[model samples]
Target: MMRRNDGCTILHAAVIGKCYSLAIGISESYPDLAGKRNEKGKTALHLLAAKPESFRSGSAYTLRGLGMKSLIPLLILRTIIYCCIPVLYKESQPVNSAEEPSNSASIHKLSRRSSFANYILGFPWLKEIDDARQSHAVAVMLAEKLIRREDWSHYVHTEFKVLEGSQFGISSEKKNRMPDPLIQATRLGIIEVVQEILSVYPEAAYTFDGKGRNILQIAVEEEKWFLYDYLMTSGTNMDRMLSAIDHEGNSIIHLAAHQESPPSTPPGVLEMMWEVLWFKRVQYDSYPYLWHLQNSDGKTAKQVFETNHASLREKAEETVRALANTVLIVSVLIATINFAAIFTVPGGFDQTTGEAIFLKNRRWEFSLLMFYLAGGLFSSLFTMGTLLVIIFLRFETEDFYVSLPCYYVINIISIFYSAVLAIVACCQALIVQKVVITDFRPLVVLFFIYGLMALVLMETSYVIFDYAYHLIRYCLCYRGQES
Candidate 1:
């Protein structure tokens, strides 16, 4: 029944402590505390909305894929242990009620606290935090419970009135603005809270923050890609929401084009490419007129995007140029080596016949040697030519969108093939020489060389393949749009 000086009740304290049992018990017994705001005008749910780590959507992605295999057995063990807690508690009870301590309530509280602590300690990898999956479940359940008892309309009105008062010079009793749980959740990318609020009162989606931005706009501004997509497809008033602009007269498209590589984007994606993808995604979904529509700053969405990405484009150009120069040097060296290899002849020319000695003694070996030598030389020349084309071309920002990536693909592939052929030709030359070996040393050397080649290829082509993936996707999307 008592509250802290900050106006926070025991319900708020329980939620903050992440004591889910106490929080749920409090909500069930004294539901009114669920809606009570502290001095800051934040209820228990409002505080929870700001904590992204409590939800699965906000959990670290490192514990996925391969990590899941290791976690499965631990999760199963935790479940088994959790199921046995109640049985252990009942079995340990005193046989006679009279034998129980006068301070039995204290023991019960201590037991509950100890059980929760044990649950947390079950996962060593979890550290001091609860398992994300379990925390997420409790979060959803608490959100659902609060939403069921909340009168959302009063909160919505208060938020709007706070904004309206500041705008029209009307006085209000509450000076500091309270954060709206749904809007705060959207900003933090906590989709569970937003979803729960909207499911109960879909009209809450239409509410705006102090800056006159609805949840959709906030999602775009904060780069909450998943939440933005969800809001767009949640079958709300799409047209109205899409057309909604902030007080600054910037639409969702402008907001989308505003930021680069927000935390939501994958780390490996190229910055310029990620920026372009975001702008294009927003452009495609929004009305065409919005593309050229000027915001309060007298800039269109495209202009804002280009302005924001100017440095990224320069960096991309420099990266491509540097890669081309380095690869060009390697290609030239490969071409020289392979060309000379063609003339030397693996087993030297027969002095009398004036032909390769291998041609007469080992005709197939000579032919294979010539084939690889010629292939390596030609492919190296092709690589050098492709790289020259890329280096000489003007690296305009638009060129990065497609032209540079196309040339890079050709350059990398050709150089890779040339290197492989050159190595294989050298191995074939050893065969033509019929070099003597005692302990399978030659085979071991060959395997070692091939292993080095594989490692080098993987190291070199990792970034190239990443770029090529996004490039291919971009091309397909462009083609589809045109069609």
Candidate 2:
């Protein structure tokens, strides 16, 4: 209504707080001035005219007492603060009129064939030919690369099969046969397309082809190291290609270890392979260490060849040990030092006793002693324990009782060390720690370090391997869906 009166004063209208709500209700009776605006479509002058009229007519508003009428502008200001801005906010946001991607049927359909096919076909490829002709291997690799280009497509189709074969120079019995194309692709390291295909064909990803090579083994043979590592790691089979033979009973590691030169399985290739199976700590059919793993000929990976190959095996062993055990080594050392240490290290001899009881010795020994102090040593319990046990064990013979005190003292010291180590490793990760079967010591720190490293290796292997496997399966799924 004030708007209808051509008032410009927003402050006066706001200061008279309750009037705004009343104004809102009375507003519908008149034309919406906001809509029926001036020729310039502006209301800038409306506010100025309204304020002074309110101020001038309010002379009787001087109550000289306590009534809400005296506090109109303050109340209006409060009301504007508490009410006005909030109301405006509610009207400002854009409404979500667009629907969500919600059809289960369409989702399932997309995961089926058409999308997979489209992904496979849609991906662009590099057309460079490999130089070394010794490898029909290269052509096979290219063919696989071309085939993998559409991996996100959910199903296998004739065109994909044709592309797969044409890329590799290998023909197949049927148009939609998946093996040869993927085999080539796996060999080629065509990751993008492969991932798309496996998203749809998860099960098929694990299947083996005519040469008795699963796509994984084929990948290894084709020296597609990433695929080999992925297959070894995928958690599908920790032992997947460990024992897989390439027409001769040679395992994948065997082939890798047997590469005729210095860096063994190709410098960069080993790294890719390692990433795939880095965390995988599969118990070898024989021993845990690759240096100790033997082939069908009963030769360890280290023993695969006599000279340079042996060096390669040694290097692999070194790498494995270093990666898997570094954490455990450091932890164990810290834990060990944190574990043992009762009497003070002899900085000098005991002059009063006149006997050379040089107790604590080296840095490692001192480190071993540190564990108990860190644990807020309940050593007093050990002292009390020694006294009690000493009494019980040596009541009849006091001479034997002397030894009993000594025994009790030794045991108390030992137990404190044991408990501290248990606390550190267990407290750290909160894993249900395996019972440490071996005896604990400073040197044992190395064992703990090695174990942790192996655990990391296996775990890392598990994650990446599983991811690659999914990618492999996703590629298939995408392929099928595309088809």
Candidate 3:
């Protein structure tokens, strides 16, 4: 019943209503909503067919007080729904609304339509259902027509695949491999269909398709703006989707960042940018941070698009690289400022001045310092005490601009705080051990241990390689560096 302009046509809705309400032997399709009890087993078709008074063929009806004549073909096909109809039947009539199937073929086509819908909905069907596959073919043909007309959502809702091996089949994947429903729905701008499928098979949305293309990647490729819109506005944010790679190993942001320009054919690609970026999809791939992301060939989407479409590739590359440079500078500056306060570093911080002017920044210095120090201290302590047992806590990825692996940051910060508490801890341990006399032997061993600390520092730096690279790049960035 999905219409061209709107979603479902009144024609389809009426029929579906009948099929749903009436179990068998009647036109499953009708618009008599009063008799249509979606919640009740009293189907609209049953209500219509099981009229208080019986109607017969060739009857003048009102003339002798006889009921209405029979014209609705589906209503009449109910005598022997399974045996009477072949599931593969269809009409030769040029696709017209009036030209419904004469018998089992027509019923089969209708049955196919319903079955396909149920399959996509993850519902089981009865083995006795007839002419179901043929109806699926007709539905697919209709969806294809609608898609050509750019009524993507309508085509999408159909699932049009019960006709998989039928005469009008278009299942692109091999018999064993089918296109991802999420991708199919996305490519066709079928938001409702995608959502329904997701409800039935929520895992499918996250599955990468045959091309290694995730739903978001496919949506961007097809430029299904509305699908993109629905994805973001419906609470699926940019950061989450863009971060994921399709089976083909492409991220949606990578697709957007790499596309030379919006494909000339579809306007959806460029138009949906507003929705994606606004939702924090981490869309700007114009940075070196993302440059390292690789597809199956070890080339990123940027490399692929640039290779395929050279004219505008430089523009994309420049934008991404420049942005990455800026971020590098910002991160380095922040880390530098932080490092300055923590250690008596030679390059950036003046140790004597830092101590002398600790509170010289005056004004709210005392209160602000108290707040940050005390608060940061307690919060850090509490967090460590509560979270240390769970190692994965350090690895949790936040979607905020920082997108830092909190597990790493929290644990690293906690380690530093513990190092600072060494003096107190040592005092307590000393009280427990009662070893006050000079421990030259332990000190000598400790010196050897300190030598290993250098390697530990190097390993720790490597552990944060990606993050550290960004910081260092930011600090070192200069305008228009050659090569």
- Predicted structure 2: lDDT: 0.35
- How well is each residue in 1-483 modelled by candidate 1, as lDDT tens digits? 899999999999988988765676677667678889999888898878878877766764322211123333344454444333331111123344544433121112224447566676676754323444455566767777777777676545443333453322222222224667888899888888888899899888877777677888888877776787689779898777777667777877889887546542333314565566656766777777677778889988888878877777777767777878999999999999999988888667878979987898689877988999999999999998888898888866566556665676788778878988888888878777876432477568768877777666655454445556745754565521111
Error of 1 at 391 (Å): 2.5
Best by TM-score: 1
Index of the highest-lDDT prediction = 1
lDDT on C-alpha atoms for all candidate structures: 0.70, 0.35, 0.38
Which digits, one per residue and each the tens of the lDDT, describe model 2 over residues 342-387? 3333344468875323333344433433443455244333433444
Clashes of each: 0, 84, 27
TM-score of each model, paired residue for residue:
0.68, 0.24, 0.27
Q: Give the TM-score of candidate 3.
A: 0.27
C-alpha RMSD by candidate, in order: 9.0, 29.8, 24.2
- Between candidates 1 and 2, the one scoring higher on lDDT is 1
Model 2 has a clash total of 84
